[model samples]
Target: MVVLKLQSAQFFTAPCEIRSRKRGNGQKFSRIIRCGIAEASGEPAPLGQKTKYNDGPFEKVFMTLFAKKMEKYANSKEQTKKIGWWDFLYDYERFVDASKRVMQGKNRMQQQLVVREVLLSMLPPGAPAQFRKLFPPTKWACEFNASITVPFFQWLVGPSEVVEVEVNGIKQRSGVHIKKCRYLENSGCVGMCVNMCKIPTQDFFTNEFGLPLTMNPNFEDMSCEMIYGQVPPPFEEDPVSKQPCYKDICSMSNPSSSLCPKLLA
Candidate 1:
């Protein structure tokens, strides 16, 4: 008799096939069948058996990729404090802690720009050249949102609304409303979200894909709004840049005065 082991929640996304034999006929069949996104319904976490990440092939692969990329940039220059050793990259929590530590000493603007540079280093040169330009920015944004962004984050944030919104007499081509951000909540760092995620991510999509995006994260609920094809306003005019940090922050620093200089006391 074969001993069956429990699977992890991320197993559904990995490319794996398991064979199970029929007791009576000895016919072999697949234990888990790959699925199409079109067939799934609202807020469903399907095809997941367990929650432990150790057994999750997909999670392992993604974490490894992210870690390697970070390693490349973290060691490239000794000008800043070393974030983490290559050996520590496999663990997400460890990486986050190290990243925050490396970013903590810098001012608000410097923190955002430093993280932005790290993200850009991970992208291939001439990236948007690969994407066909026959479509408008809005169309391209929508397609990318469906195929990549939404799918990539859905598992972490559950179901979210991908919307189109107008602000300041300008219409955003695409927008994604995250009811809650898992990374920010889990990492418990506002600086990490702004510097490592929001600013850098926005710059990456805008520069690489020629699609501008502005991410507005609500600290109270950990919700966020990603508006695509809309460039982030200047620091002087940006509300988020001027917003105060959470009264209680993970980095143990003041956001209004330290993290966000534009936000006056």
Candidate 2:
């Protein structure tokens, strides 16, 4: 009996299947398949499992590259601070921590502006123009954009799927529904999610790339929807601008205030 140990979670003994395949050396390889995670406990698998990354080598490379880029743009002075080499999740947490540090001593508008610059710095030369030309505000363009966002951004946002949304009276698959946002969960700060992520991302896609994008975040569950081809409202008009802090999760949360203290900073 060959044992196929799962690295993620415990497997159910009854809901499993055994299979065999012959290798090139005439060796029989035994494989076991368990019932899908949905039927059991919804402990979602790691993002790397859904990609071509074998044993997390590619994930480590990508995470390291992105983390260095963030630190470079955020002007992080702590050169001695190092993100985890092998632990991608810990690296992500460090990345968010860097973002929070960027917001220190900065007002609301300045925070958003600096984060937007960091995002633009990460992109290649003329990427904004290329994206604008490739993805115009059309049904097919929006749908295709949504489909690609799932795999391309799953590392940062976690598991997400393309969802259908109505834009300008036309139904299109231009929405990306995130199961749970990795950044928000890691930071646990409403201000970080808004200034560092939501506002900067919206500005990057809409202004820089010429593709109007809106992000609607559910602070209660940490789920979010990214709708391409939809213009994000101004901070003065959007309700998220006045959103309260996460009382239990955020260390800087002010329970007495109705709105996030950082929102007024």
Candidate 3:
């Protein structure tokens, strides 16, 4: 007989004694399994039978991996901030250069170049130059149609027809509207949107002109995603009228005629 002891939830259990069975070779073998939580005093608290193994190596490996990942995450975050200014400048310069190159060409190539130029020109001036430098002309041009030109014109012209609705005795203003989109190609979209909306002008650091010219990267595609998302699909039914709402506000109404003469023309 062999005695095996284990700790319970709040107390120790009586030793469980088991007699070993003899094998054909006249040797006796016995197996004992216990399950429970360890007690406060560092004793095993058994609830039932369980398998056990050494976990020290696994714990050490996990800790090492976790530490490495954390270090990498911190390093990447720092790198992003450090590269932000340079990336913005590069994108701005590339966009300007590409536009010039496209303008000097002709035919289908010229049409594509014009579209690219228009889209790039629409972006905020502080986009990361690194990202712009990476874009192929085809992608840059296509992105402008899908994300930039469409969305900006949509917002400038308004999303829905203005119909007066009264909230109380006095007339109240309410209409379906698209909020300005933020750009996130580089650092993040919120920062770009703040600059576009000119929110930072309230503080002296930004000044009445907002960010200084040196800090400006002139990202023309900052609002691409924003405009793309807000600009209703050409095939989608209008929410208010249940009619096809394919017409772009800017193109149809010319709301941004004064602001974007190049586009209007």
Error of 1 at 248 (Å): 3.7
Q: Summarize candidate 3's per-residue lDDT along 171-239 as a digit string, tens digits.
A: 322222222121122122222222222122112112212211111112332222221112222212322
Q: Which stretches of candidate 3 lie over 4 Å from their true place?
A: 1-92, 104-110, 113-257
| Tens-digit lDDT string for candidate 2 (188-226) | 889989988898889888899888889999886788999
Which residue ranges in model 1 land beyond 4 Å of their true spot? 1-55, 71-89, 132-136, 154-159, 167-173, 247-251, 254-265
Better of 1 and 3 by TM-score: 1
TM-score of each: 0.63, 0.76, 0.16
Cα lDDT, all candidates: 0.53, 0.70, 0.25
Expressed as tens digits, the lDDT of each residue in 65-160 for candidate 1 is: 554555444423323333323443344454454465556456666655666666556568754566426334665555445334554554343335
TM-score of 2: 0.76
Scored against the true structure, residue 40 in model 3 reaches a CA lDDT of 39
Top candidate, metric TM-score:
2
Root mean square deviation (Cα) for candidate 2:
8.3
